[model samples]
Target: MASVLRRKAADRGKSLLDMILKERKFARSIVVLVFKATRLRLSRTSHKPGSVVLISAKICIKSNSFTRLVEAEAMVYVSRSTSIPVPRVYSAFEYKQRVYIVMERIHGQPLSVDWVQRSSTSKAKILEQLRLVADEMRKIEVPEDAGVSDICGGPIYDPRLPGRSHWGPFPSISAFHRQLRNGIVPDDIRDPESIPQDLRELFLFHQQLWGKPVFTHGDLSSLNILAKGDEVVGILDWETAAWMPCYWEYTAARDANPQNLFWREEVDKFLTPNPQAWEAEAIRKKYFGDL
Candidate 1:
């Protein structure tokens, strides 16, 4: 596997592992191991939570190309473009239809865990910091030459659509909304008609509003946020991030399952008022019936 990875890296120009390992002074400590998953696996030999280096691997079917590459690039892009903190990517390489990324391992508790103990003031401060991060995300501008309204849309490169590639890069918000009901119906909501048409209509109305492309963290769930005390030390996971419509980030955050009442209320405090939750629920009903 090492020889295969090395050859594959050479084909891409240079060995990212070779270069990055040297730079990090890893020397010979690096080990490649696997975990079980349909599409991805975590490296078992990961650094301790606060370690300066960590590695991850994703081995997918050949058609998947290199989604891990997209993830690494997104992290690097966020680190360079925003005040938001993300693990620094040391290297990313594709070999034998597998993708690997070496990066910093942030040491912090999941915000979901920390939020339970946080005082109101600390929670408020964290939300404020997130608001600033959101603002910074809005400042990211993709070149017009990219020729797509949704830069991270479709099968070209989005971690969200793993099994398929030709999905979107929608030309308009309405176009994206039209495809929202693609989810598989959950057992509880198997009846499509149970989802109110009024809700669907309301969602579409909001879709007609103006939406400009901006960088967005595709998943802003509490688990993805790493916090120490009152401060956010890291925002983990960037595979779904893309230059999406301005509302995408807030919408995703807003729509995330609220694990408790405090989180339910805090969410409202952090983002611009949008009807994303309604739309997302409506879509969920349509596809995965009430899931």
Candidate 2:
């Protein structure tokens, strides 16, 4: 019900409706709509195979879809930082309280769970590719007020939004734990609260370690990637792009769920163990309790 309503006194994630209406210049003339995946589109006209044009909105959730529009703009703004090839953004505009951007739609099947099943694919190759992207990503200097925010879209007021201030990390990990059981985590939670212990602690540690608001595409799962000949060609679905920790981006790249989180194994091996700090912790634990 709240997702359906307009901005009241308090709200965080900008209402898709209000954002478009406010930025009339962007949304003008453009009919606002959503994209669905029911029909099978074949190569027609000059468009190549698998070319994504437009579709109904039955499949996409409004929040993520709206976020994609923003990321499309963000992609253009940060074009220099993108390592993976992306469909060039043609234009950006908003309409009817929903925003949109025109882009050179990719003509390849997006990488999916099956794609991760690269047996002969050397881990070295994936790591090399990830490092290349990471190298390009680190070059980006996210503007202080640029694409930045934690993952949340409740009706609560987001200062980043038109009206509202956030405490911190809206839809906190505690909240996300309930919502996030897609891959490794199971859906039917037996001991629901059990998640709070091991994982939450690690999440908190990483949050502090990479707390600075930097830019990252939150939904960097396999499905969003495009591959051809063992290489990542396009990084599609920039919807969840926002300010986040530097490490967060890498963390996402490592989360190859279908094959277990091994794709990230190499990256994690290098990053997690800060030799000095790890040594200090070891010594401290030797003297006191490892708590």
Candidate 3:
């Protein structure tokens, strides 16, 4: 009964907040006040300046020109389709070319914090839970004809990509690979002399690669994973979540931030490792810089 009552109260609060947010002047004022007073900020190296802030103990709002509604949509889809612990989104909308996502403020520290100091047993336990969460995420039904795309079947955003912009809702893995090569099709290169020998080999290698698209959290960095004790409490930052090639998850995890050097070794424990894919990604990154 207490749980039911609490749920009702939460629903009421969400409704009230929704109404409050609809008032542009009032919402702007509230955002300004929260920015000045809140201790919780969801700033990341990849996120635009002043994108996310905690509005209260329970609510966080991410709003900015770089914020996309698909991020909120991804969170909602994951919450409904899987048991992966993610922030509960209360409201998502857009006004004046900016997107706003109001969601539950999950209280936990990122796994990157103190991860190296944790005991071996604690690390194993966290990895076990993360493996289960990854499995559950893979079970989500893929949309028909889906290629590389966001949850809404739109272009996907990945800061690691060269332009730090939306890429494609490509119809096939081959099409997506072509984009990765900056539109250079290996078959179209009639004269091998026109391109560098190494570049030609890289293109050929990628052309032969094939995999069915699967749901992928494109950025599986330790900094994005929140935990309490040995339990993973939440997976934050779904902006880059999408349907991608099967090897993407492993490669993305392997490409951890420079600060998270330890996480690169731990990724294989929770996610399948694809050394070949990692090699291919390294070659691509060599030619076209990542971010």
Best TM-score among the predictions, by candidate number? 3
What clash pairs does model 1 have?
Answer: 154-168, 155-165, 184-288, 185-287, 185-288, 185-289, 186-288, 189-289
lDDT of 2 by residue, 1-291 (tens): 432322231231224323443454333332233221211122434554332433222111222223335555557755756655765664455455555554554545554544446664544465467556656655667554432343232222122221223323333333322222221343354776776454444334433433344556645555666766567677776655655545445544543456445444454532332433333323433433331
Off by over 4 Å in 2: 1-65, 113-123, 144-211, 251-291
Candidate 2 TM-score, true structure as reference? 0.49
CA-lDDT, candidates in order: 0.57, 0.44, 0.78
The sequence of per-residue lDDT tens digits that candidate 1 reaches over residues 1-291 is 875644443343223444545566532223222111212222334522221122323211111333557777778877887778988766566656666666666778888886877787998889898888777877787756332233444433443442553356666545554555542222345675776776546454545665456667767778788888888898887767766656666656655565733454566677676665546555555543442
Which of 2 and 3 is ahead in TM-score? Answer: 3
As a whole number from 0 to 100, the lDDT of residue 21 in candidate 3 is 55
Going through the candidates in order, what is the number of backbone clashes in each? 8, 16, 0
Model 3 lDDT tens row, 98-117: 77787889999898888999
TM-score of 3: 0.82
Q: Please rank every candidate by TM-score, starting with the best.
A: 3, 1, 2
Better of 1 and 2 by lDDT: 1
Query: How much is 159 displaced in model 3, in angstroms?
Result: 0.5
